[model samples]
Target: MQFQKKEQYRRQEIWELVKGKEEKISRNFQQSGYERIDDNLFAFVNIGYQGHAGQAFPNQYDTDTERLLWYGKKETHSKQPLMKRLIDGAITFYCFARWNDDPNFTFLGTGKLVNYRDNFTEVFNKDGTQTFCLELEFDLGDNSIHPAWINNFDASFEAEPPDTKEGKEKYVRHKTRERDPAVVKAKKDEFQKEHGRVFCEACGFDFKKTYGARGDAFIECHHNVPLHSILGETQTKTSDLTLLCSNCHRMVHRKKDWLTLPQLKSLMERN
Candidate 1:
């Protein structure tokens, strides 16, 4: 309850800041998820608010990074106007993206378009429990953007607002480096060093030394859990790894919601 009360005050502060900031918002758009591959970082989810009609796109830190690694249509071309609208608070939606399967990770709801000047240090909560205050500014006021299946879930669509120091952080949060090439390269190198010698748990495959039919049979490492759950934490283990081929690994993160390797295995078994 204390957290909730804090969130309220935070929202009031954000509203006050934006009351007369008057800036023109654009019109063409789309939103998507952003991820930092090497660190296995789930890109921050960004929400776009447009006068009254806003939608969220998964954050894709950079077009090139997203194009090179992620499997979706990277060149689909997003509407810049839409992105600006959402960021500027003309539209409001719960635009969040996360990996639900990793046991080692926790869930977080994040987005781009931060409040004033992207001052994350002053806005986030102490324990970093959640970002409730940031979301209240564009509160849909009893509107539900989630699908029907999730409509009944008890998430706050509209509440008094967040006022906590933690709630305040949302306004200052930005994607940081949604697609930092340096960060990605470093992460990849780290993963290789730690997992290069390890074998795959599912098939005893070796990724570091060899390839498969495509070439050497190197083992594939998996997060076992989602990165969003592990954000702000350091040191992940290779033992929590699963060895699969490129195909299997791709299939693993496909669903993004309630999708897990074990669950995939179950589906395979039934078939």
Candidate 2:
């Protein structure tokens, strides 16, 4: 069950998708914040909200969407069966975030674990109970997360448009302008006008040279501006794209911070 980015979902809707009218599972439907439907996790998160144990978990996502901190639920411990699912094998972590008191949650996409601190969080409850929770840092994947997270973080829905800041800054991600065919053609047109054909900007790998005329005008477009560096405020332009061969594009996104074009070239120089 995959949740699309920026799409708002209700508790019942999620229950329907994960378990189809299964009574026992639906009974515990809204009970667990971290629910496991098979190997993957669905995090129903409310930042700065108090759990039933009166212990409010300090779930936070920085403006850059760099360090996504998820607090374990009440009585959750390190090395537990469920907790192990986070870093165990190749599992996807999905997040649904909402404004305070909002009915629906917007999907934040799959996350990649960067760091985990077992029992590093302390929460004081209103009932005089102290809970030591675990904190896990899972930076959401750029492609699936940037759009949804950009719309809701720090947003207040009571008396506003829910975009937080009342400015004219527009970002394309959900509909994903970068992947649009028109955008790709525009970039190719501009690049061919200047450089004659598409090639890797970082390593200068010409696909056509490597594979005859069959690879003509063939190159991948790396979004170039790292999502973490975007801070959810800048508009991506055609110039923001950098044409690259497949290998160089993957290398650029190998790390969380994402390597710049110059940094990739420096590595090539060393090699």
Candidate 3:
């Protein structure tokens, strides 16, 4: 499946993104199964209709770490079971999160089922009948989308190789900002309006142009002004935000002395 626009997925629209054209079966998290345990980590449960009313016991799901164990739905009597689709290698899953009521679901990127097991667990039905149902375990695949908002996820501004003096100074100079989603959208929209498309301001790399549908309108937001340089509590203007491709963003922070936008442009020209 091609990557859908992240902005297009907002509020209740997530259901459409997850189910696609498929009819809505159940509204229960286990049925429409998605767990937003943290900002970076998400799990999709493929449990079928069985044990729908039972307690969801998430084994090995420790919030402090990146590891997650999703319990698959109990096997159903259907011809092609949902749990069966997970076993097949062709099916791909993407995780999403709407952290702290941010309005937009942060696309946590694609994941693959790492491991599975057959287990019998106690499940209590609505009528109070207790039954042990068969369940499968699913582990998240890729670690590409590690956002700082996640509880234990590494922050981008953290000190690099803290043993050296330069590393310690870089850490002290690093600062983080509380950016507003609305402002970030406005900045992207405003740039797209004038330039006809959003691209890396430094390298002119466009995600949509390169990856087609999957990468449409996807660009990392960078705070232009150094966070540590701000004197007091100040509002961030849209002009203060710059758009960059992931590669350029990493290059900007490649060294202890962060590269300014102009400096990056200069290096690009020299090359």
Candidate 4:
């Protein structure tokens, strides 16, 4: 989803705009709508699914659109900023996917949630009127593609919870390999040496040795989607990569609130 910060707008207005007329907008729907493969056999796989929804906001904008921006306190409200609205839009899209009926569908990554504060900005217009537009953009293949699925054997409304623990145990993944800061750094360096020129794919920036006498510049490499399910016996190319900074990477993992790469970029510009 993408937006240009312009003026006061309601969360509902953005929601309505992104919530397409279709019942479900998934990759499966894109590849091939509901179809019968054989007798008693039907498949609905929407790999390109992103969820979005509304959260808590007490203070409401009196504008006709009912737009309002609230901080920690719900009642005290103001105009919703473009960045927040865009993130909310991405969240809404991701949230809606929970209702999809595809056995081989997963979100951008581990299907985890992320949360962060939106940074706002004000741009002036020719009429001397200030307009705030929300901006957002993402590379779906990297951020939202995973091995998560939703299945309905009887076409029922019930959704069976996934075996998260079992999947983890069966995968035989090295938990430490994935999380150890040293391991992450070493692997990143290795990839850079072999690939040549370490830079963020989403936003170009080289690794910095230090910053503010405290930190260094670092780039994160993320699979545009997940790799395990599509890993063995088949190799995906580098084009299937989405690189991000620490901040952007964390935001990508926002559970209840998130934004795509494109969406995130849009928000940054507006801010």
The RMSD of every model to the true structure, in order and in angstroms, is: 20.5, 13.2, 17.5, 21.4
Ranking by TM-score: 2, 3, 1, 4
Query: Which regions of candidate 3 fall more than 4 Å away from where they truly are?
Result: 1-177, 228-231
lDDT of 4 by residue, 48-86 (tens): 233232222121122233222222221111224322332
Candidate order by lDDT, decreasing, is 2, 3, 4, 1
**Residue-by-residue lDDT tens digits, candidate 1, 78-197:** 123332333322232332223331112212222222222221221223454423221212111224222211111113212233233211122223331111122222333455577664
User: Candidate 1, which segments miss by more than 4 Å at Cα?
Assistant: 1-214
TM-scores of all models?
Answer: 0.29, 0.48, 0.38, 0.26
Native-structure RMSD, model 2: 13.2
Displacement of residue 22 (Cα, Å) in model 4 is 43
TM-score top scorer: 2
TM-score of 3: 0.38
Across 1-271, the per-residue lDDT of candidate 3 in tens digits comes to: 3445233345345555445547563455333444332121234332222334444344443333433454433442111333333333223445543323334555534544443444444555578765444343233334433332111112322323222221111212122223245556667789999999889999999989999988777787776654434544566677887788877776765443568899999998999
* TM match of model 1 to true structure: 0.29
**Candidate with more favorable, higher TM-score: 2 or 3:** 2
- Model 4 residue-pair collision total: 43
Candidate 4 local lDDT, residue 40: 13
Using lDDT as the measure, name the better of candidate 2 and candidate 4: 2
